[model samples]
Target: MNYNIVMGTDNKTLNPLVQQIYQKIYPNIFKGSKDIVTELFLAVSYDINEPPVIDLSQSVQLKKEDFQSYYTSELSEEELFLDVQEEALILNMLSKATFQACFPNINLKLKLKDTSLLNINIKVSAKVNIQTSIEGKQNYLSATILTADLEIKDAEDYKKYIDELKKYILPLLIHVLNKDLLDKIKLPALTFKDVTVSLPIPVVEKSFVTAYSCIGARQPDTYTSLNWPAETVFAGIDSHAIETMAAIPFPLKKEKEFSWKIISGHVLAQVFNPRAFVIQADGSIEGKIDAELLAQLTLKKGFFKISFGPHGKATIKATFKPVVHNGRLLLTVKDLNIPKLDIDFGIAKWAEYLLKPLSFGLSLALNEIFLPLVSAILRQIEIPIMHFPTISFEIKGITFNIDIIEAKTSKLENQLLISGIPSVR
Candidate 1:
């Protein structure tokens, strides 16, 4: 399991095969409805040192040199001023847009009339305030509020409501936050079953080991085998998600020891050829625990049912650490040793002194029932874990950012190597 991804040089990294992401780059850098009529005439035009409120019987004449001649600045000897490289080229083309593909028929909203006020509506559409009546017909603009709210109050009127929500409520909150963080850039998946870990009975007497009662078994269920083959590289400089992997398997069977207690007497084990290994350095997961136990002794003091010869197998060597309490992610079962066991036939030499104290009480109840039955079946398997497929942008006032960064997986070309960086926060 080795994954590493961190891309963001303007995202667009792809070609792991064929390649495709041209939806005509969204009308070639957004031209939709002529950029919503130049962002509703620069969100209600501005840039004035004075001069605005007009009403000359019906005509059009409200310009601050059409918003300071679409903002121009030089001064090193040329003289101009409203920069940020031309409002960051219309805020990076309305941050890769979405709000219904940038306003065609408008709708934008953002309420909260209480706690510090903050409204902001938009609506529009019906030929957006049509007008042309001198007798020529077609009429509709005379300010009947073609839907346009605003409000904004705290923080010193937030820079005059972000300089009039950078023309059209900051590109409709950067295309509705680039479609809500491009649907959270992918990552999900998990699974598990037949879990019932419970072990204790240690009381080693002369050798000394503690715990003493709690036996249970049944942990055979799996899922979380993954693969994404490849494809999903976008790079204006970086963006990735190719070759994903998470193949996990755990097979432990021995007639799933139904259940048991003490007193009356009855034990039956069969753990054999159990091999596991996943030591990413010290993350732990070592295995090898062959087994086979059978008992039924109650003797002259009370009960009896003797006939235990399967005491013919034992070979330990364990370790399965991976613990993360509180937020669970366990697998404890560290360092357990058995070495060898195959008693000497003929009632297995007095049943190896009554199965050496019931084989050290089933090895301290299989290491205390493998951490809460494999951490409650891996917290009930979830999924997505970087499925990849996203794109969105915007960079100033009405925030929005995400352009891939880190995604790795390549179980021999199963494909997945995504990484980029530059959009933190």
Candidate 2:
């Protein structure tokens, strides 16, 4: 396959994205001043029927420029698309300073030649400044010459002038745009550096575009492979890729209400030990920890507090169901049990009578106190995603955060699919 990573965005998403871009970059849209000339003002109006289109490009070409196809095909291929709220655009300037221009109506379009040659077609309304030379035998009735402006008299001349503009505007605009905006327009929508995936080069289609790349292979690879240029606007990854997740633990915490007297329990400590998140199709993660947790028994006499306590160490085996809440990773301990437990507290033959009852009490603590307390602490525990947020791209010196919608194993694919959309921080 030419590509394994496929992503796309359609028109329904494009319209608002254009408007959103307009709001952000509007203030800085060609914002600069020369003491030679300053105070420039620009106002653009758009019709509901048409809106702007944006792409991931370092250089933008004028609509009327000659077509140069990057990947041409004898048979037509579907175009790539990403509808974003806003994007940076470049424009040329000759002189500014007390200058004002209002484009009454603007319609922008993306046209593709062959497989992926693209040019942005912009149609803007401009009122032409024309001086009239025609004079009627003005007041000829009185032999007095005068000049009068009539509508239809200059109609043909006006058409010719506007038609000539299309030819003149493109070459001039493109030259200036390419020279000034190459490094300034940062498109962060497709940057996935943290995931180690390169943004796919976009291909032009009829009205949409799709970006595809055979970039990086997922570790602990997934099944049900997809054809390049798939319909989903998403990133597919392996669960094993999140190295930090392995540090997360399902531990029994000490709480005054239920666990003040309990021995400590912590799993998957990063300094010495780490674990992997093994995702199952049902949205559960199952793993066994080899580390030990302590369970203690105590026998005390009156106020003197002479005591005997038998402490046990257990290798905790557990399964957890993780969920995201307000951008926090919270684990719900689905199951916690000890398959093996070792306990030995040497006591005199006189205290041997206390061993059986002590054993029974400890067993009761395992089911009644230990399990419930562990589960409760696990429930209250939360790993804030914002603090340890996943990084994606860096543009305009700003990093993008993954707004994950769901993290689940696709039974058919046998891979953990993290579904998300673009979000600005």
Candidate 3:
């Protein structure tokens, strides 16, 4: 299974990345004049009047589909949205139109379709895409722009002015953006040779044009078996405790018509050596165990007598559901079961003692105590997965961090996968 280390980009990130690119090409940001085909010597120059906003007319509210829409410009999917209004355009409409129109402001939006290249300048790109990468030695993401466009939406009369502006402004914007974008997005991913970054159907917010790009990844080879850090589970489980226990014989007692035996021996409380935790492809956890049962017991027909064992060992296998409560990560044990109950002394020494009780009665002691015992050890000791940290990777010496939230486990082929929402930092 492929594990995706998602890297998200937003305005807070985009603005700065684009800024560096724009800065290098500046000093004069669209304060000039142009002669229109109508012999209109329009000398239009303006300064930033109001700062850019996502959209003052409304607050940006998005849905899950907003980030995965098929139609470009679906919602809040563009790479950047900069709606800027200069103080106002001082225009000289030369010739027959030798008059200055009192314009409120020149609304120049550097609105990227996939999008952005923002400034007070009236030039924008058409479509853009930010994607994950497993190819790089260090970085996690690679950003690319397909095309760009700028809409002088309110400046209908300024058509001639815009046409001339695009000649130089647009291409310059695209070049700078392409260079900077590649360098800024650096996210870390599991890049084992066997692992693959899936290029599934590209899903991202709306774009103005058609452009598709996607990325995914798989697990590192070493993940097949993982051991719990604590090294031990429950109490008194060590050495060949199993071999010695299995050797004990169940003592038999004679009775009228029915024979009986009272069993007493050693048993490991936990099902297995909890430290040897192996996560299965199906998400089940099987702990390693060297198991043997020791017993001396009395039993006849449908009834049996039994007590605790000290040398015996059992096996505990379970599935885990990773949960987060109040920001603290936890593995809630689920489907806890005992796969092998090979107790010695012949039968099972059981949890405590089951006198004349049915076999199901034996489940009462071990079943009840086993699950909680293992779970408590993990929580109390602060196991590693319990405090998942912000994942980070570097690119060209720059480091980027992604916080994993709402984390849960999933099946990825034969590997254990823990996927979560990537909250940007």
Q: Estimate, for each residue in 199-240, the C-alpha lDDT of model 1 and write its tens digit.
A: 211111111111211112211121111222222321110011
* Pick by TM-score: 2 or 3, better one: 2
Worst 10 residues of 3 by lDDT: 90-99
Q: Quote the lDDT for 295 in model 2.
A: 38
Which candidate ranks first by TM-score, i.e. highest?
A: 2
Query: Tens-digit lDDT track for model 2 on 188-297?
Result: 32223323443333433332334444334321122233432222234333344322343444243442222223322222111112245576777566655443334333
Candidates in order have lDDT scores of 0.29, 0.34, 0.34
Q: Which parts of model 1 are misplaced by more than 4 Å?
A: 1-31, 34-169, 184-186, 189-251, 254-269, 272-286, 295-308, 316-340, 344-425
Q: How close is candidate 1 to the true structure, as a TM-score?
A: 0.26
lDDT of 1 at 410: 22
Where is the poorest 10-residue window by lDDT in model 1? Answer: 235-244
**Model 3 lDDT tens row, 1-425:** 32222222333333443344334323333223222222222232333232222111122233223223323444353432222221111111011111111112233333322333333434242334434444443334344443444666545665655755555444444444355433454434322222233332122332111111112222322111122112111011111221122122212111112112333222233222334555555555444333333333334335633333322355555445444543333344555554444333233445434443644544343334433444444334321232234455443344556555654554444334444444544
Instruction: List TM-score per model, in order.
Output: 0.26, 0.43, 0.38
